[model samples]
Target: MATPNKENAPQHGTTGTAPLLLSRVAGNASAPEILIATMHGKEAVLAPALALLGFQVLLPVDYDTDALGTFSGDIRRPGTAFEAALEKARRACDATGVPRAVASEGSYRPSQSLFPGARNVELLAFVDRESGVEFVEYLTDVPTRFVKGRVPADPAAPETRALLAEIGWPAIRAMVVPNDPGEGVVLPEQVFKGIDHEAALAEAFRVCATHSDDGLVHLETDLRAHMNPTRMASVALVGTRLIERLRQEGYASAHPQFA
Candidate 1:
């Protein structure tokens, strides 16, 4: 997904007292090609920022990144998020035949703070094989609207409907799965996703209950970046952070110490 054009140059907006990182444009002379390793349309958010620094952003396809892991629990993500981001970037570079690439990864977990039930930790990475430079930046959003809970078999019940309303269902897009596995269900058919309508909700609940030993359905917000607007915004913010760093520095940029 090509990022929508904003302006030729990125705006210098800083949230804190820190100076805007728009001191100098990067890769302008060489105009390096940047391949964004993302399957969830993240380029739509990142390209404009990289464009400001005169980097051409490209999106590559036919990558089995899910073999690495997924936001959903269906496949477990490997190593730390920083590791995952760099690995994804390397894979994207290999696939596109581009030495410079960008990648993003997001981690969702219950908030340890007092604000909300959950937090979104978004990470972005840039890899330049020519310079042997691999850098990453990360940000955490405590105001994230992540929540999950279990619903009874009958979603048509009044209390269940109220729960749906509280979770902002039919808009946020929910996923339903069995509360527990039955004796013979190697792979339960209760995993229904992208569910937003009341009709689909009822059906998912019925199937999950009928197939599960616990007779209950587990419902959750779909945390995929493309599926969740809040998460996608975080991805964009992190991309901007990467752009800021690139503008302010050269080959070496600030990143968490990795071993």
Candidate 2:
């Protein structure tokens, strides 16, 4: 059981696994492996950073991470992002037969004291079982790419095209879902590249609207690392922090508490 003072020891809906691991840094090649558990598709940005620190970075294949939660707002995650991140890290360690892991989780919303769309926060974590150390990091910004708008089902709506340009296109991808949140239908793949033709986008919107509860489609940026460059940048920043924590001198020394 995790202690109450622990940052991630609340009611996270996950099975049994140690909350953290610790590593004693040696020379370069023999450094312990660190698994980065994520469904946000972070391998490209994060793996390099771990490699730079001489720790092998691993990602699990068989686990269904969506069981934890998803970005489409369908599943209500039980714990805070920190708890969820530790759960994910523990899952990776269990699956790979390794003792150390790393994971990250992100949340986005408008500024509480501001207008409808204002700012966002991203949280990242690194969990080590050998030393029982879990390090947390965060970043905040008001220039997020999150936005949503309702468009008619019509294939040739002029307003839809205008909205597309308003949001950075051909670069930052958009999420397509039913305007009604209750319908539980989100088409993440329907995210169209702004570089694609207007006809393609119109068709995409039409398909989403046809199945929507209110015959309206909601469009917003995908926000996943591979989809949104802004998110990728954030992942890179998080990766740098994780690497630094792993390289700490205190982690290099032996500790009786771990034994």
Top lDDT prediction, candidate number = 1
TM-score of each: 0.74, 0.71
**Candidate 2 lDDT, 1-259, residue by residue in tens:** 1111233221212234633332212223345566667655676677666655665455553345666766665555556666777787877676656677777776664435522343676667777777677777766672446666777766457766566666675477665666533235445553343324556666777777766767867766666666777787787777676666656734322423211
Q: Using TM-score, give the best candidate's number.
A: 1
Clashes of each: 0, 12
Which regions in candidate 1 have their CA more than 4 angstroms from the true location?
1-30, 110-118, 180-190, 211-213, 251-259
Q: Could you tell me how far off, in angstroms, the CA of residue 56 lies in candidate 1 after the best superposition?
A: 0.9
Native-referenced Cα lDDT, model 2: 0.59
Residue 226, model 2: Cα distance from true site in angstroms: 1.0
Clashing pairs in 1: none
Candidate 2 RMSD computed on C-alpha atoms after optimal superposition onto the true structure = 9.2
Q: Evaluate model 1: give its lDDT.
A: 0.64
